[model samples]
Target chain A: MVLNSHQRATIEAAAARIIPADHDPGALEAGVIDYIEQTLATHDGDHAQSYFDGVRELDELARRQFAAEEFSSLGPEQQDRILKLLEEKASPFFSLLVRHTMEGFYGDPRHGGNKDRAGWTMLGFPGPSYPKGYSSPLGWYDGHLPDDFASPKKRSDHEPE
Target chain B: MSRNEAVDVCIIGAGASGLVAAKELSEAGLSVVILERGPWRQRSDFAPEDEISTKRRHFFWPTVEQEPRTWRLNAQSPTEFLSADVQVFSNAMCVGGGTVHYSGLSWRFHESDFRVKSTDGSVAGTSIEDWPISYEDMEPYYEKAEWTIGISGKGWSNPFDPPRRRDYPVPPVARNSAGAILENGCRALGLHPFPTPMAILSRPYDGRPGCVNKGFCSGYGCPVGAKSSALEALLPKALATGRCDIRPLVMAREISVDSGGRAAGVVYIDSAGTEQFQSARLILLAAGGVETPRLLLLSKSSRFPEGVGNSSGLVGKNLMLHAPGPIVIAIFPEAVDGHQGSPCTRVMQDFYKTDSRRGFIRGGFVHPRAHGGDPVDYALQPVHGARWGLKHKDSMRESWRHYLHSHCTGESLPVESNMVDLDPEVKDRFGLPVARITYTSHENDIRLGSFLAKRSREIFEAVKASKVIVPPSRLRKLHNHQMGTCRMGNSPGSSVVDKWCRSHDMPNLFIIDASVFVTSGGLNPALTIEANAFRVCDYIVSEARRGNLG
Candidate 1:
C-alpha cells in the first residue's frame, strides 16, 4: 500500500512502540503498520470507515487550530500536541483507530491482520493457549516477561511529545 | 427417482438447545439435517473497529428481522419500535443461536425454579404449575450439558445453591479489578460473591483455545471456538458425523398436517425461493420464542383454527420476559479495567431466594460484568459527563481505567395480557403476519424492580464504591431472554403443548425452545432452554423408536 511518508512514519512510530521486540521479534519489523493499512483498505471492516473518518477529521481539527499545513510539516512536539487535542475532543474515535491498528498489528492471521503471530512472540504472549491446559512448563514466562501488560504506546499515554 | 434430500432429522435454529439436541441425536445413527436462519460468523468476525458491530449491530445472527412483533405499554398504546438492547428478547438467526454472541454464562435454575408454584406458595391469579420435571430429572443432563458445551468455572453447592453433581470444568475467570473491589466489599458485608459458572474455555479444553481477554466478547462470536456455541462447539461435532446435513437459508413456512391431524411434513421455502415439502414422521420445532409461535399460528388447517397447535388457544399467550433490573455502576479509585474478564464472571444470588418481604413472587439475578471500554463505549461513560474542548480530552485520558458497569437481570412476573398475537395487517419480508407483541409490566413489576434497585444501591455502597449511579425505575425493556409463549400443561385447554412439548392438537409435532418455557427463569433463559432441550431430545429419540408419532 502507498502511504504518505509522514503517515508511514507516524504509523511506524506507533507500530514500533506497540510491538517493542527489543530482542526477539519487532512490531514495525513484523510489518504491523502495513497490516493496519491493508486491513483498512481491503477487509471492508466497520473499523475501516471510522479510521478513514478519523484521518479526515484529524486533519480538519489540526487545520482549524494551526491552518492547513501538512501534519508532518509540524514539528514533532506540535504533532504530539495535535494528537493530544484529538484525544480530548474525540477520544472514542482516536482511541478506536489506535486500538484497531494495534489489534490488526497483533491479532491472529486468520482474520487477516497479524500474519505470522509475530505480534504474539514480540509481546511474550505465547500463541493461543493449547488445549492441554498449560501442563507445559513456562520456558519463558518463568519470569522473562514483565507483568506490566500495558503496550508501549499506552505506557507513555500522557507524553504529549 | 433418486432421493434429492435425505436426513432422519432436520433441526432448525442453531441455538443453546437445538445444537445440543442435534449433537446427541446425530451421534445415534440417525441422519440429521440442520437449518440455521443466520450467518455463521466466528471470532474471525471481531474487527473491533468503530464500525459494524458497535454501530450497525451487524453481528445479526440471521439478522434481527425475525424478532417477535411486540408492542409496548399495551393494546391501547400503538406499537412502538424496540431496539435489541432493551429486551434481550433477541434470538440469533445464525448457526449458533444466541450462544454465538452470549456472555458464556451457564447457570442452572435453582431447584426452586422448577417448584416455584409449590415452594413459593402460589400467587393470586397466576397459573404457576410446578415444572412437569424436577431438578433431579435434569441433574445428570445438566452435567452432561455442561461437559458437552465445555463449561469452565468452579461449582460447588455454594450454601445458597441448589443441588449439584460436579464442579465446573475450569477455575473461574479471574475477577477483574471491579470484581476484586466488589468481592472485598461483599465479603466485608458478609454477602456471598461466588465466581459465576461460565461456558468459556478458561485454560483451554476440548478443541478450542482460551480467552485472550480482548474484552468485548459477549455480543460477538468467538472465532477460536473457545466460547461454547452450537456452531463453534456442538453442531460442528454433529456435522462431523457426516450423518447430519446443514441447509442454510431455507425457511419453514408451516407444518402440513395429514387428515388424521398428525404433522406429515413441513412446507419450507428453500433458498431458491421454491416451495418444497420435507416429509417426516416426527417434526420438532426449535424456531425460538418469537417465530415458533408465529409459525404455528400461521399453519391454520381444518383440524386446527388458532393455527396448527391452537386448539388450546394458549399458543401465543402468557408471553413472559425476564425483568431487566436497575443497573448501578460504582466507581473505584483503582483501575477497574472491567474489559479483562468474561462478562458474567461473578454474581451474588442473595436475592434469588423466594422472598415475600420484597412483595414479589420470585427472584432475580444481580451480576457483575467487566464489559466494553474499547473506545466508543468508554467515551460515553457517565463519569465522563458532558464534553468540552479541554474537558473532553481530560476524560479521554482516563478512558481505559475510568469505569466499570454492573447489571441486574431480574424476573418479570408473568401476566396473561403480555403476549404475541398476529397483526391485523403488517407483514415481514415474507408475507406472514407480523408477530405483534403487546406488553406492559404490571404495577407490581415496577414495585419489584424499584425494591431491587434499593438492594442494588446497598450492595454498591457496602462495597465502598467511590461513586454509585442507580438508574431509576421507568418501565425498562425486557432482556432478550423471551419465553413462555407455548407453555406446557397436562390439559390441552390450559397449555398449547403436553409436558413433553408435543403439541396437544397436532400430536406428532413438537415445539421446544424458549417458546415452551412454562415460566421464565429469574435470569438468562439460554441455559434453562438448553437443559430442557437436552431432556426433551432424550424423550424424542426414545419415543420415536417406540413409534409414538402414531
Candidate 2:
C-alpha cells in the first residue's frame, strides 16, 4: 500500500510543520517521510491505512480552508495554523503523525531516518558508543576530571562534514 | 513425529530457573535435556550497543508480531491485540531469558515480603497471602544464588533488609557520579541509601571478565560476559557436565502423561517445524510466569480435564507484575553525565516495608538511575516543555547529560481475577491458543505508587534539582518483571504448585519460574527465582536418586 503523490506531499508537509526546518535540520531534512514510507511496508502495516486516512483529513481541511488547494500547496504559515488546530482538537490522526514524524526525525539512522546522524549531531549525542566503550574508574562521580575526557571523538565526528 | 531416548529429567525453557535446575540435576549425575523455545543467543550476539538493533528490535525476545498475545483490562472486556511496543506481559525468549537483557539489579526480597498477608493483613479484592516457605528457609539458598550468580554489592547497609550469612561474592561496582549525587540527597533526607546489588561483575569472578562500563545495562545485554545471566553463569557448567543436552529453538507444545496418569514426556516442535516427543522420568516447566501456566492449561486430558495440575482451578489465576511508580525525572544544575556507568549503583530502601500511615500495605523501593543511555528513548520520553521543534531538541540535549530519573517498583497483590488464560479468538503461529493477560492493578498498588512518588519528590527537592517532572500515576504495560500466575502454596485447593514448586496433582512435574511466587515483593524476582530453582532442583535430584519420582 504505497502512498499516492498527493498523500506523500500532505504527510511530508505535515511532518515539516510537526518538526519544521529551523537553523538545525528538521524532520524534512532528516528524511522522516522516507522512514514513514518504509515503515508502512513492514509488518506494522495495519496502521498504514490509518496514516493515509489521516493525511486525507489534513488535505480535506486544507481544501475547505484555502478554497480547494492541497495541504502541501499551502504556505508554511497556513500549514502551521492547520497543525495547531489539529493539536487543539487532539485529533488522533495528527497525534499518530506527530509520533511517526518524531520516530523518523530522532530514531536510528539505519532505519532511513535521522539522515547522516543530523538529529544526533545537532543534539550533541555521541550516538551508540560501542567497540570503544567508556573507560572505567569514571571520575565524573567524584567531581574529578581525567583530563582529555573528549579524546575518543564520537563515531559521527569521523563522518565527512 | 520422532522419539528421542528418555533422559533422567526434561526441563522446558532454559531460562534462569531452568538453567539452575539443569545444573543441579546434571551435576547430581542425572541426564537432563533443556528444551528452549528461542534460539541459542550468545554474548557475541549482544556485543553491539545499537539501540535500534538491541532495544527496539528486542534481540533477546521475539516481537509480539511473531508470538502474538492478547490483553484485556478485565475478564468482561473485549480482548485486543497487544503490540510489542505496549505488551504488558513482556517476557524474554532467548537462552538466558531476561537476565541477558535486564538492568542487572539482583535484589533479595525482604523477610516481611515472604509473609505480607501475615504481617500486614489482607487487602480487599486481592489474594495477597503468606508464602508456604519463610525467609529463613530461603536465606541459605539466597546466599547460594548470590555467590553462584556472582552478585557485587555492600551488605547490611539497609537496616530493614533480610540478614545474609556472608558478604556479596564481590564488592559493589564503582559508583557513578550521578549515583553519588542521589546518595548525598538520600542521606540529607535521612533515608538509608545502600549500594545496589548487581548481577554484573565489578571484577573478574567465576572465570568471567568484569564490566567495561558499557553504559547499556538497562535494556541491552552485556557484551563482555560481565552480567551473570543464566546462560553465562550456570548453563555453561551444566553443558560441561556432559549429562545435560540443551535443545534451543524447540517449543514445548504439551506435557504428555503415561497410562497410569503420571508424568511421561514432552511433545515439542523443533525449529524445522517437526514435532518430536522426548520422554523423561521427570518434567520441569520454567517457561516464565505466563507461559508456564499456559502450558498447563493447554495440556488438557480426560483424567485432568481442566488441565494438568489445575484441579484447584488456579493454574492461570493470581497473575501479578511489578507496577512501577511514577518515574520522576529531575534535572540538575550541572552536567551529571548519567550515561557513563551502570544504570543503578545506589538504592534507597527506606520505604521497602509495610507502613499503615501511608495508607498502603506494602511500600516500594526508590532507586535513582542514569536516565537516557539510548538517544531515541530520551527523545520520546516526555522531556518537560517540549512538544516539538527547537524547544524539544534543546530540552533533550541539556537533559541527556544532566538528568537523573528514579521510579519505585510497587508490589502488586495477587488478585484471582487478574490472570493469564487462553484467548479463544487468538492463536499463535503454531495454531495454539495465545495467552491472554487479564490484569488491573489493585487499588492498594495505586495508592502505594502515589505515596512512593510523593517521597521521591522530597529526595529530588533535597538534591536541589532544577526541574522535577512526574508522569501520570497510572500503571502501563511495563512488564519486564512479571510473576505469580501459577502460585505456590501448601494446599492444592488454592495454588498450582507445592512448597517445592512441584505441581500438587503431578508428582514428577515442577514449575520453577517466577510463576511460583506466592507474593510479588517490591524487588526484582530474578534472584528469588534463581534461588528457588536451585532449591527445588536439589529436592528433585534427591528424589531421582531415591527412585521416588515415579
Fnat: each model in turn: 0.00, 0.45
Off by over 4 Å in 2: A1-11, A37-58, A85-96, A136-161, B476-478
Q: Considering every candidate listed, which one attains the maximal TM-score?
A: 2
Residue-level lDDT tens digits of model 2 in B340-451 = 6777877778888776788778877887787636766677676558676567766766777777888778788888998889999888888899889888888888888878
Give candidate 1 misplaced runs (Cα > 4 Å).
A1-161, B1-6, B46-55, B61-70, B84-89, B380-384, B387-393, B474-478
lDDT of each: 0.64, 0.80
Task: Give one digit per residue, the lDDT tens place, for model 2 in A81-161.
Answer: 788788889887776787778778767777778898877777665776665656544424434422111223322343468
Residue B77 C-alpha lDDT in model 1: 80
Root-mean-square deviation of each candidate, in angstroms? 8.9, 4.8
In order of listing, the candidates' clash counts read 20, 1
Number of the top lDDT candidate: 2
Tens digits of per-residue lDDT, candidate 1, A84-149, equal: 677667666666555554455445554445557664444333443322222211122111212122
Give the CAPRI class of candidate 1: incorrect
| Ten contiguous residues with the weakest lDDT in model 2 chain B | B83-92
